[model samples]
Target: MSTETLIEPPLQDADALIADMGGRARAAAKIMATAPTAKKAEGLRAAAAQLRGQADAILDANARDMTAGEANGLTSAMLDRLRLDAGRLGGIADAVEAIAALPDPVGAEVDRAERPNGLVLRRVRVPLGVIGIIYESRPNVTADAAALGLMSGNAVILRGGSEAVRSNRAIHAALAAGLSEAGLPAEAVQLVPTQDRAAVGALLRAQGLVDIIIPRGGKGLVARVQDEARVPVLAHLDGICHTYIDAAADPDTAVALAVNAKMRRTGICGATETILIDRAYAAPRAIVDALVAAGCEVRGDTDIAALSPHVTPASATDWDCEYLDAIVSIAAVDGVAGALAHIDAHSSRHTDAIVTEDAAAADRFLAEVDSAIVMHNASTQFADGGEFGLGAEIGIATGRLHARGPVALEGLTTYKWLVHGTGQTRP
Candidate 1:
């Protein structure tokens, strides 16, 4: 089939459409499982080339989505997430190429053991079969999902938000064309055609066909998928991430990191939604002042309110909210223990950071914080697969199971036990 025709067939019954896609994905996944790593790399590289070559066309489609988003009253942060310009497209293409350059995780032996019976057993990495990805507004997710899924030897069925349907279709077409050019089945990466909400329900119930479902969006969407999915789900509940300024923190460093953590692409899941300042810190006021100066709205407790006139008094709900915009909630804590307590009470456990010059304080915070990703003296914005050298991610898995942190190539794989024995029989 031609790439232009890869837009999925007309939507009929949602169940039947999902079933057909699931079956095709299952079949394509088998081919991908044993496909050579070099071929997979070639496919990803080709896709990157296609993205770069067709940047202008993709941007045009994205412009349509942007206009619609504006009409629909999407927040400035959301518009940023939905918007795609030439530079961002180039960055996306570069990320795909980086994925192609990474070492293949499949077939790598995770561990080996020899039993008393002289049986040599090995655990080897393998693909997770077909993955169903339901995400929102980010058109780049289409390419990221395709690249990560193909590189990890899995077929993907993407159900993106209606806001970016046109952009998703365009990006998916380029990806499918690249897969075909590399002799990989174009069916390896398929996007659900219709925006009907029923499509999500159908996909959730496709338990046997889809090995797992990964939902990447708001809390409501993730909760819905978790509640409705019959298949296993890899999800992040929320990004109510926090950054605590330790009592021993450097004033200059703390201010710089806090500003970047909250304002550098505020719409991303990694952006800091809350800032916890240690009461004993010499300059708690400085950190809050810096954030306000950087065009971030600070919603604060009494201490923070006292720091600046612009600081708005925070409500009870503000502490638990994930504001994916140019806003942050600030609170004062006693020390590391106080910060940890506050985080334990309200954090989504996605990502958290502490800025401190004290080695012991930093070590203690790192050891104590029960989050997927924790850092000392670094911006929470670093909680990303691309930043971690995994190219791109389906999502930051807040759940602890097969994966945690960035759901990259390694996280996408499962392992099987391979045993070698000489005519051994059970006693």
Candidate 2:
């Protein structure tokens, strides 16, 4: 092994790079602040076309990143996230094109009221200025985040993981070309140039430069960004999602939904991590068999493990885990109350759903559960922005105030009060 810094050509200085990005982004944010809807739409349309045109270049860059990732000992799941196929590339373009179709959120009226003093008050939506995104392995995020940020009239600076640096740079270049073609500010969507760790440090401390910092990845990376960043952060810590089968639930429906929830795209944040089964009506034998058939290893409580030799005995730790893989954690609860308590103790407050024919149970769970997205008789996978009809999303926000649930265009903007009076001053 060579005795050198892990990152090639170790970057000891971040001051110049940070300052350049900061000035450029701040200037871009100003232009976006007052950009007309037609202009922004044109930019998005141009970007989508350019992305499609540069498909071959993007693929080549992705191949290089994938090769390096394998040499660096990245896991299979990580590699899957890093790699992009033709369909995925098309989807990314489609998303940008779709964003062009959405209504311009900027300058929309939030609320209007008529006062007794003959004054009219209006609240209008406005962009949040510059956004800094720090993500891991997922190069698609470079396109997704940039599209969302630009559409909402905010400049963005993306910091992708080192493993996908080359791919991100190529994507960034294509986007920059689009902005230039449209006569828009090219720095509207900039990518951090180097893979040095100090760059992250500089980004975290750029309070004046960045309006918000969004972290998308595992819990550890998000936590670190949140802790270190001086700017405000929008983040999802962990998607410890869940699905509960109520006592009055249909066995067939439960078995099918549960199997699909855990097995379909298990690496996503929306996938079911823990399953709550109502002991009163669960067809434990048949359900366990279905899960096994779907290639999931079951870890359950003593009673559940005793029901079939297929299940392994689960410990207390199993109740509070988000296994983003084929492994599932199971528990048999007394009823809705017991299930809620279990979820409350372990959930990451991201997404949770219940499959039940009983209206009362469904209503109670929907009202009481504190997760961002609560579903009734639906798959937990629907917690995504695209599935929720947002067309695209930067990431789900687990934070409770101001913005919650699937973050979309409306969530990206803030409101300001506008008042007009016919020669009427403060009375």
Deviation in Å, model 1, residue 81 alpha carbon: 0.5
C-alpha local distance difference test of each model: 0.92, 0.87
lDDT of 2 at 373: 90
- Overall local distance difference test of candidate 2: 0.87
Q: State the lDDT at 397 in candidate 1.
A: 95
Task: State the lDDT at 396 in candidate 1.
Answer: 98
Using alpha carbons, what is the TM-score of model 2? 0.95
Model 2 lDDT tens row, 298-335: 99887789878889999888777777778888889988
Candidate 1: residue pairs that collide: none
Please give the range of 10 consecutive residues that has the lowest summed lDDT in model 2: 1-10
How badly does each model clash, as a count of residue pairs?
Answer: 0, 0
User: Which segments of model 1 are wrong by more than 4 Å?
Assistant: 1-11
